[model samples]
Target chain A: MEVAYLGPIGSFSYRAVKLAFPDAKLTPVATLVDVIEAYEEGRVDLALVPIENSIEGPVNLTIDQLFHQSSAHVVAEIVLPIVQNLLVVDAKRAPEKIFSHPQALAQTREYLSEHFPQASSVPVASTALAAEIVQQHPTLAYAAVANLDAADFYGLVPLAKGIQDVAQNNTRFWVLGEKQPHIALPSTAQKVTLALTLPENLPGALHKAISTFAWRGIDMTKIESRPLKTVLGQYFFIIDLVSNDNIKYACKEMESLGITVRNLGKYCIYEGEK
Target chain B: MEVAYLGPIGSFSYRAVKLAFPDAKLTPVATLVDVIEAYEEGRVDLALVPIENSIEGPVNLTIDQLFHQSSAHVVAEIVLPIVQNLLVVDAKRAPEKIFSHPQALAQTREYLSEHFPQASSVPVASTALAAEIVQQHPTLAYAAVANLDAADFYGLVPLAKGIQDVAQNNTRFWVLGEKQPHIALPSTAQKVTLALTLPENLPGALHKAISTFAWRGIDMTKIESRPLKTVLGQYFFIIDLVSNDNIKYACKEMESLGITVRNLGKYCIYEGEK
Candidate 1:
């Protein structure tokens, strides 16, 4: 299968796509939209996108795209451990400035504060791009927080390692495609993803809709709403159910109560076990 | 009232906070965590943090912080339109590169792709900081996408104005405080907020919980869920309802169904007219 992932070949998302489908032909895109567009345009059989990071929470871009594009299904899921290092152009630089992706910088704020007391840190769009900037600048006084692969690609030397506040940092990626992969056991799988919205503004309408799930003992894994963008008050919801069958029933019940329901498909169960 | 906001002054969050609390004392912090910490330490009576943007969706850092710190209440909400401008130190300087906050850069990707095809765009943590970078590196042919206030502060001229692809781009900020504000309404308000979690490994539990709200005819304004972090599959939801009474009733019903209900407080209706 041909797979599309975000990158310049060394990005974490690229690694994730490879890890999940090792033998698949890979295509790299610069943005999430490109990846989705590639999938929608039939350029790739499947696309891998980062959905959430353990430290950063959900990636809104991916979620928004998933909601907007109705054709793709979340076919598989993968969680990859993230390790960031502060790489520099020279060992004796005593870097006066550091650059990294905003999320990476946020994750390593405490470490940077404590260790690089006088250094000014700036955010970049991506860790790999930050490394590329440091290399192109010809400044030994700058460092970048990125993965080892990014450092190698940009010809930077590791200045410090394991800078993230949480040592167990991990990012979760979802594989999206037109066809849903068949899971071995549908009963054993524990999570179901659904997208829905309520009818026009009516007093006490949302409380009544959610009660259907709560009343039936369906555990919601996730529930996020975005404005319909057409009307001021209308909003749409993306919810995840603990059981696939439970979700089917819940969707039926929700529709009966005038709440529109759309199942986005499911992936491997997160058993909550390490 | 004294309010704390994230910024170096002239930042989007700062403007949003000022717009929300016109007569209040606004304290600017470099980070959102500082804004939350100030409120937690009682240094500020309230805090305003950006929660989501129309183009970008939710601000995961602020949302994750809300989940991380359970004591704060979201007392009010405000949505402000965002217009990004490309500012440069010298108009004559050939724009070889551009810099901006990641969000700003992402929001203006189409503009950059069309207008500055050859320019390399760099992302920073804040627009104000990006403006500062341009000022410091005046000899370099660089520009930044920032608000007019930031351009004026850094003495940069606007190379281009309102470059964002989405004209309806807006950001929503949550006014957080130790206690919910008691705003007496001339008419009954139409918004309520709640936090909830379902029982462990329970099938169809979430569906049952939400069904109560649906049955009560309450319209949901917003609904979002975050992983508990402590457990992989466990999640907690942050929901907004049309009426406090309806949400209260739905909570009672959910609790009876064995769902853990946490009331994060409610606020007056947000019509977005202001």
Candidate 2:
């Protein structure tokens, strides 16, 4: 199957797709939208996008895109450990500036602050692209925070390895496709994803709507609220719940409480451990 | 009063500071950390940082920095309308490449996709920096998405205006200070902010935590989860509730239910009219 990912080849998303499908035909797209568009146009069977990172939190654009384009289904998820390295043009270059993707740069701010306090940190579109820039401007006295694979791909040398502040830095990627997976159910599997909106600007309106899930003993794994572009103070909640029982009853109860609940899909457990 | 913002004069954060306190002494810092550091160092009475945007959602670094520092309190908030413009060297320059801050670039993606479909988009450290790059390399045919002020500062002309797809786009900026304002009584404040964490990975842990506020008729204004950075499964929730009641009781109840609750600070209610 053809799998799409965001990249210039050496991105974490590219590595994630390779890890998940191993030998799948991989197409690297420039933006997350490109991946979604490719999947929508049937250019690829599945696409991987980074949803959240342990250090940087949720990638808001990815979440918004998921909500905006309701056609795709999150078929699988993968957590990739992120290791940011300071790649330089050459060992001889005395780097006065560092470049990296915005997220990566933010993730390694503490390290950059503590170590290279004098160097100016620049944000780039992508880490691989930063490496490419360093390769093109070999005498520019610049370094980039990127993966070792990217450094190797762009013929750059490592200035420093594992520069991220946190050793436990990891990012969770969602695999989106046209159809949900058809895996045999496991007894331990118990989760549901739902997107819903509350009634109006009434006091405690959202609380009342979400109460149904709580009262029914359903555990919320994730609950994110995005402003409904149409009206002020209105939002749509993308919720993930853990419950072996069917969510139909709770969802109905929520709707009865003036919540417009939309069942995106029900799938096997998240299997977060994997 | 002196107000510090993360920037170099024409940065988005600087514009936010200007929007909030027009006559205040605006100190431009190199980084967001510097903004916070200036506040901590008593160099600035107030600091403005972009917290969230309509197009980009929350700025994770700002949130994490706030959480990590914890010394400052969010005294006030402002939502500024963001209008990004494409500034180029000249019409004859017919820029084949574009540069912008990652967030600005992301916000203008749809516009850029439609207008400059084939041009490569690069992310610069900041909008002002992008403008500066265009100024220094006028013959390189590079355009930047920045504010009108930034374009003027760099002697560039607008190639396109209001390039963001969302017309009513706005970014929420928080004014953080060393001490919380002593507002004698909570006004008809419809929103309260709190930071808390779940007890454990139990089946209905979050459900129980959220039920306390919901069952008590508290409307949730916002709910965002961030990884605590302590453990794999642990997460911290930054929530805004609608209530003028004593939040201490809610905090106590949440703690009683084995949840860890921290009262960050509460200010006047957000009108949501903006």
Candidate 3:
């Protein structure tokens, strides 16, 4: 089995792919688009990308591509509590520049503002890139807000362990694959993901959109409004809720109510170590 | 009147601020947090920040700052259609670097990838800073993906106008202030935004959350689930829809349903131009 993820070498995404598919051959790609493109083109078996973060709401790029533009199925999900460390060359010296992914920078925002108020921050492609760049330029007093895995991979020492301001900073990664899982999931698996597009621009269309599920006493766990892309103010909703067979019924019911619905996947949420 | 906005100068936020309050004395701030902080601390009369984009779902920084972190009320909203241009030092040569705000960069990802595949894209603080830096570094072939206003302000020439992949890439800006408008708003100013917290972790809490408004035939324009920031999977919902005093009644009903609700604001949507 082959897995492609958004990476340089050792990103949080790399950590996610590793935890989920320990035995699969891993391939690091430049962008999230590249990961999905590779999968769509049949170059990879699965494409894994960050979908949401506890600190940052949702990875719009991944979500937009999945809902508005993709043919691949979100077959599985993995929630990893992001463990970020400050990797630096000179621990004693106050660094002038801090580098990391935007999400990493945001997670450690409070810590950075409080500790290194004067230091300038830069956004890189990934945390792995930050580590790689910081490692390559040893003369500059540059620190990377990245995972310990990245530090270990790049032979860098942790300046500060768990530097993220919020301890509960976790990112949920979605597995996009052409083929569905051959093995049956556990009965305890409950979450079902659906993307619904309205038939017309009716006044109460959105209110009615949720009514189908709500009337059935189904829980609406997460709801996101994304642009239809064709017109401004028009949106398609991406909803995640707990269900088993009721999910299929709800989708059919929504379709019957004149809404175009897509079952992105029916998978269990990751309940692993934090 | 005074207004605080994200700036170095000449960014899209700057454009929105100018469009909304053409005569207001604008005070450019360093960050969205700063703008909100300035407003909360009474340094400025109003704070203007991007709330949503047609391409990108929502401005997480502004939304997060306003909802979970601030006490200031979001009083008004202005929607401006983004007009981005390809700014260049030289039209003949392909630039090696493209600079812009992360939002600007993301919006022009398709155009950049296709036209300047080899040129590395750098994320700056704002579109204004990108234009400023690109202007100062004429020796280095640096181009900026910014608005036409920035190009004119920085004395940079536009390589291509309306270069955004999507033509209707509009952004909605929220006005944060201490006091709500004194005068009575027109009845057509019906969109009301609310932030609601569930009292307990229940199966149908979310379904119940929206039912208060949905059951009453109120149109749900937009519903977004944002992280409560206290817990990982826990969320506080932001709902916007067309309503009058019915929104207040719905809020009361939601409270009756044992949910903690915050009236973020009752403001009219920008309806100037498409």
Candidate 4:
């Protein structure tokens, strides 16, 4: 299989792809926007994109692209526990400056504040980009916060491990493409993503929309709302349901009530090794 | 009054402040996080922060900070139409690279793709930072997508004006402080921000929570949901109601039904000159 992910060989997306499909040929891209563009153009068979982190809520561009750009469906999801570490090179003493993506810096805030309060923090595009920069300037007193894979890929030594403030740091990644996943299922598709839009903005519009799931006792794993961009108060809601059967029922109920329902594909999420 | 705004000087927040308070003393800070930190520490009498753009929805850090860190209320708001300009030090040479904040870059995607398809784009912390970099390195073929004030502040010439894809680009800014606004009002506040959390996650919890407002004909101007951070699938709903009387009625109803509701603030939004 051919797969594309956010990488310079050692970002978290690279790790996610590795864990989910160990034998796939990997293509690395620079930006989230590029990933979607590449997938839409059929440059890669599958694109692995980070959807949300437990600490950071949601990755903004990924959400925007899923809403606005993709014709592809989410075939599967991979949940990876994030382990942030402080990696440095040739530093007999503490580094004066540290670099990482904005989300990484935020996740390790408490650790950095306690260990190196005086150090300056710089945000680059990604954790892999930070690791790459630290590699180019080997003589400078600089460090990075990234996954364990990045330290090995960039040839840096770990100064510290598990530096994230909250212990339960995890990210859920999606596999988007034309083909659906053949692995990790319980005979029934375990999850379904639905995008719904209201015909008009009214006081009870949202209440009526989600009640379809509530009335059926379908467990909604996630619900996110974004503005329709037509005017000030209009919005579209993305709902994640636990069962595909529930999705079928809800879509029919919603459409009958004049709400527009767009099914964004249904597949089982990868639940890790047996 | 002394106010803090997101800046390196001459960013959109600066423009928002100038329009809202014609005589207040201004102090520029680097990030949305910094602006709140400065405000909480009592270093500034007021902090002006961007809440949502008509295009970009809500600024994440601003929403997160106002939810987690502040005791301050939103006293007033300012709405400004955004006009992004491509500022270059010298229009004589074709630039090889362009820089701007990620949102600014996203807003001008069509313009960049059409005009400079071959140019590499760099994402900086702010649009002002991008302008500063282009100014300091004049020999490098670089340009920035920033406000008109940034072009004036950095002594750069405009390569283009109002290059945003959408003709109706606008942003809404909040004035956060301890006291209520003595400025524009109808003798009673028109808007009130409410943060509500459910006692537990259920299929229809959100449907029920929102129905309190829906049943009353309360016009919701905005509603944003963020993960509660305590667990996955749990969320806090930030609801912006248009009427103060409606907020009182809804809060009473929600509390009676065993839902938790926290009033963030009640303030009038600045409806510019007649």
Instruction: Candidate 4: list runs displaced more than 4 Å.
Output: A53-60, A182-189, A201-203, A271-274, B53-58, B79-82, B166-172, B182-189, B201-203, B271-274
Candidate 1 lDDT by residue in tens digits, A219-246: 5557777777566657777776666456
TM-score of 3: 0.88
**Which residue segments of model 3 deviate by more than 4 Å?**
A54-58, A101-103, A116-126, A180-189, A201-203, A271-273, B53-58, B100-106, B109-126, B180-189, B201-203, B271-274
Model 2 Cα shift for residue B268 (angstroms): 4.0
Clashing pairs in 3: none
lDDT, candidate 2, B1-274, per-residue tens? 7888877767767666665566777888766667777888888898877778522224766777778665677776665668899998896656788988766877899899888888988766568888988899977889999988888788999988889877766677777875543322223343457777776755566666677776666667788777777787567888887655756677788888778777656655322223
Residue-by-residue lDDT tens digits, candidate 3, A184-212: 22223557888888877454666666877
- What's the CA error at residue A65 for candidate 4, in Å? 3.0
CA displacement after TM-score superposition, residue A189 of candidate 1 (Å): 4.5
Calculate model 1's interface RMSD in Å. Answer: 3.9
The alpha-carbon lDDT assigned to residue A205 of candidate 2 equals 62
Q: Give the per-residue lDDT digits (tens) of candidate 4, residues B18-65.
A: 667668888987556778889999999999898865222236557767
Task: Sort by DockQ, best first.
Answer: 2, 1, 4, 3
Candidate DockQ values, in order, are: 0.42, 0.43, 0.36, 0.37
iRMS of every model, one decimal? 3.9, 3.4, 4.1, 4.1
Q: How many residue pairs clash in each candidate?
A: 44, 0, 0, 0
Residue A241 in candidate 3, Cα distance off native in Å: 1.7
